[model samples]
Target: MKLLTNRTRKMDVILIIVGAFIMAVGINLVYEPMDLVTGGFSGLAIIIKYFTKGFIHGGIPIWVSNILLNVPLFLAAFLLKGKKFVGKTLFATAVLSVALYIVPSFDIVYHDLLLASVFGGVIGGIGLGMVFITMASTGGTDMLGMIIHEFIPHYTIAQVIFVIDGAIVLLGAATFGLNKALYSVIAVYITAKVMDGMLEGLKFAKLTYIISDQYEEIAKEIMDKLDRGATGLHATGMYSNDEKKMIFCVVSKKEIIELKNIVGGIDPKAFIIVSDVREVLGEGFIEYKQ
Candidate 1:
């Protein structure tokens, strides 16, 4: 157990570093060059860089702005949320800043706003997803969001983040232009979708709830034919006043059809509800140890 904990910590650190680098690549190579400010301190950094070009060399670097913007937030997080909440995040944010400093800026999209937004969003999403899986965050808007949520307990941190990032995007729009801002919205939406897919496993399965009097035969058929296990959930139908074992089974996408066929064949009048399972783990699924 101790070894596993150490391994997990190491993996988390590695992921934070690699993810932050990839995120930096997206920002410097595509988003920065194209002036597509999606959101976060990175977005603010781009705006600062653009404005300071005349006085400063390449304006203020993204890393500089990132660290600067995040400092007060980190302090606030430490004080408000305590050391435990801030430790992993502080390290992750530092790694992100280092990544932004090391990754070179380039015109990856050749000034194509559409291409820039799409590719940048995808890349950023992938990186964010990786960092998020570790149950840590790369400060910036994330920390700010959490801090803000402290004052308003009614609103969720996610809601506060949406508002903050939205304001930043609007600021970017004002600084850049309407057209670029519009493109940034697209990038933001894409980033969110990709990030969600990352958090939820990419490999999807079907979860079927079989409500039939003949659940035993159906469960057996599923186990034998699909090589999947089915759980019999104790459910009481209020309307019918009937207590029964509702069959609950999860199967791969391909196996879902066969499962349905078996249930349909066994009990034609059976009530079957099928839904998508983002991920399934254990036997015949994702091995958690790996």
Candidate 2:
């Protein structure tokens, strides 16, 4: 087994704490002020708070409700996911719950549902993305998703999560009304998009395949000028039955123009195919982790 270095472990803890705090800010500051309900345990807490406001004095604060709801789920996660997984999840959930209590809530940009939804989504997405980067979850529907995945291995975790969170959003609609429910959907969508962006990285790359006669010159230029590597593959022209070389390379999106110019300078008739690459992990990109 590989052991984690001290710094890596410390960074994991920091990420969990900061992520939870950001999520709390999004919920309390943005969603709560506008009474906008999104999915997951947090949304359920908001619903509980709204209903209990009449009978329960100051009402059930989100932190209390969040803890109350997570208790049993945490127990289940420990039993199912084992100690290591449950430990990180517990850390994140605890931080989030406590943050809900400590973080002061006030409307910074009020009376605008659109702005609230957009900002809340962006903030929450960043928080969730950070937690995910540590390979830990904030333990709400995340736990539920794992549990559901165990039972029905055929259905993807994401599919199960969507169904469960969708149900909660629908319940919010019944409790809050249709308009708020629709707004909640918008928030969820924005949150998902932003989260995906964070996870996949905002800076994209391009993978290009060049079929040209001047493959050696082009490859040399790419390696020398762009500081990028290129691979030459042996190929045959289907029409002419002549041997040829295909150069394959990956470069940043901005570098695509430069790459095209280099290829054009070498061989104007070069057949080049450029495709968007979501991620590239190697010498010039993200380091591959075991």
- TM-score leader: 2
Could you tell me the TM-score of candidate 2? 0.86
Scored by Cα lDDT, where does model 1 land? Answer: 0.85
After superposition of all CA atoms, the RMSD between model 1 and the true structure is: 4.0
Model 2 spans with C-alpha error above 4 angstroms: 1-4, 146-160, 202-204, 279-283
Q: How many pairs collide in each candidate, listed in order?
A: 0, 0
Per-residue CA lDDT of model 2 for 1-290, tens digit only, reads 23556678899999899999999999989888788888889999889999998999867998988878888888888888789888899889889999999998788666688888788878988888788677677888867877778899987554566678788899999998988888887788777667667766654799999999899999999999999999999999999999999999999988999999999999999999999998788788776766
Give one digit per residue, the lDDT tens place, for model 1 in 1-290. 89988998899989888888889999989998888888899999999999999998879998999988888887878888888678888888999999888888889788888888899889988888788777677899877876787899787544566678778899999999989988998888777677767766556889899999999999999999888999999999999888988999888888889998999999999999999987787878876865
RMSD for all candidates, in order, please. Answer: 4.0, 2.9
Please give the TM-score that candidate 1 achieves against the real structure. Answer: 0.80
Output the worst ten-in-a-row residue range by lDDT, candidate 2: 155-164
In model 1, residue pairs whose N, Cα or C atoms come closer than 3 Å (at least 3 residues apart or on different chains), thus clashing, are none
lDDT, model 1, position 72 = 80
